[model samples]
Target: MNEHDFLLMFSCLPTSNKNEWLNLKTFVDIYNSKHDTNYILKSFPENDNRTSPEPEILLCDGDAKMVIERKVFAFPPSYIRDHQLWHEFHNTFLRQVADIFSDNLYELQIKDVDIPTNKKEIIALAKEIASTVIEYKQEIKNSEGIYSDDLIPWSFFQLSDLEREDSPIDCGVCVRLKISSHFYNNQQLNDSLPMIEAQLIKLLKASAPKFDNYSDCLRILILEPHTKVLNLSINFLSQVIQSIEIPSSIDQVWLATQFERDDEELIRDYYLVVSNL
Candidate 1:
């Protein structure tokens, strides 16, 4: 991530209960609007020594009560570590490349290179990338689109015309990830489905015990996947839920998803799955 973007994302980090209440309120509002039910936020119960396990959010509909247990489906530790390392590598590469190419926009497609976490190795790789771009800039200056051979490990595709204009900072670089046959295989989605199912089962089993105290009230299990790439819907989850044994205490299961518009605006929605509402 760029410095501007890194600052923008982290600076607005969600505090304890304020942001969380807003999120839960949004979900409750959507539920009320769609299902024609009037449920209002009562209180966010505290989890203390007296209450060993408390629901995150409580809703009251006059005489009736609702309990929501929010859970985030997180990525595996190994994947998260790799993702962070890659971001560091990209940032380091940009710092080196910006000094070298200052006037034009270049899209560098790096391939077949194992990204190293060591600072010295990362610096060496970044320098090598900058030098490679400088060496081939003149040879492919006139060409557009992909200009490298199939056997070549990397390809350089200049996105914008080499328009040299006076600017304050260096040029913009958009680095594309390496593409391989393994990424295009049909088995990738198939492999991921099982992982998703396993995660769902684990989350359900872990959260079920929290609802034991709320037997008098309607119990809800809200699962929000930490990613937006997967196309999760009621139908897909319905099929997966058939195999797992849902706890008797859970009255309903809902999947919360976030959608991003072309203008970068975000909209969060909730879909009911395994419902007994």
Candidate 2:
């Protein structure tokens, strides 16, 4: 089932004492029953023991194999931070299982935490995380495909093609545009450039004479994707492009359009073309 269905199913399940151990046990029981699979759930060993416990849940097809860990909690900002106990437990478990599972093992962190208020928000987050995990797993499965290929060399798009020698722009703008082009071509959807533009405009409008360096502007932009800003007029994108002194070349314009289209393979092909040029 999809993430939303999973969440809804989880919500329908009976609530327990809300204790971590108890909640985990309930999940294990429900999951096994629902899937009609033999999944054995075991508690982690105490700190005094030299051997780390096997993962929380083991799914067996023939022998016990797949491992999953459950972390249930109210939403806390520091839940995944390095210093947090949950984070420590997660890292430790991965390290312990590194050799035991060898190649066939999979790790899943199922969290029943408070999600954002938006509709299907939890599902959206879950899907994004799951997609990332699937991508990583696929990469690992195709080890030959990875090691057989040489790394592509980093190359820059030609600014000379812009045909405007006396363009009034900061050197940082050129650098960022080149980097953006590189990422866009490689099918990397980095939401930082537009974000930075918004922040830069805010700061510029606030303090007329004060100038911020490129890195400072970029740092603000890279904070998060501007979902709110996306709903604004097309003029917003134009303003950002103009502020960055981006090239007016037809190729550059077409590349930007490809980014808007969000076709992954096409973007990658564009990147190849730009790199070759």
Candidate 1 has an lDDT of 0.62
Top-scoring candidate (lDDT): 1
Worst window of 10 by summed lDDT in candidate 2: 268-277
- TM-score to native of every candidate shown: 0.60, 0.20
Candidate 2's TM-score:
0.20
Candidate 2 wrong stretches, greater than 4 Å: 1-20, 42-54, 57-62, 72-277
| Model 1 TM-score (2 dp) | 0.60
Clashing pairs in 1: none
Kindly give the number of clashing pairs for every candidate: 0, 1
Instruction: Report lDDT (CA) for all predictions.
Output: 0.62, 0.29
Model 1, position 23: C-alpha lDDT score = 62
Each candidate: RMSD? 8.6, 28.3
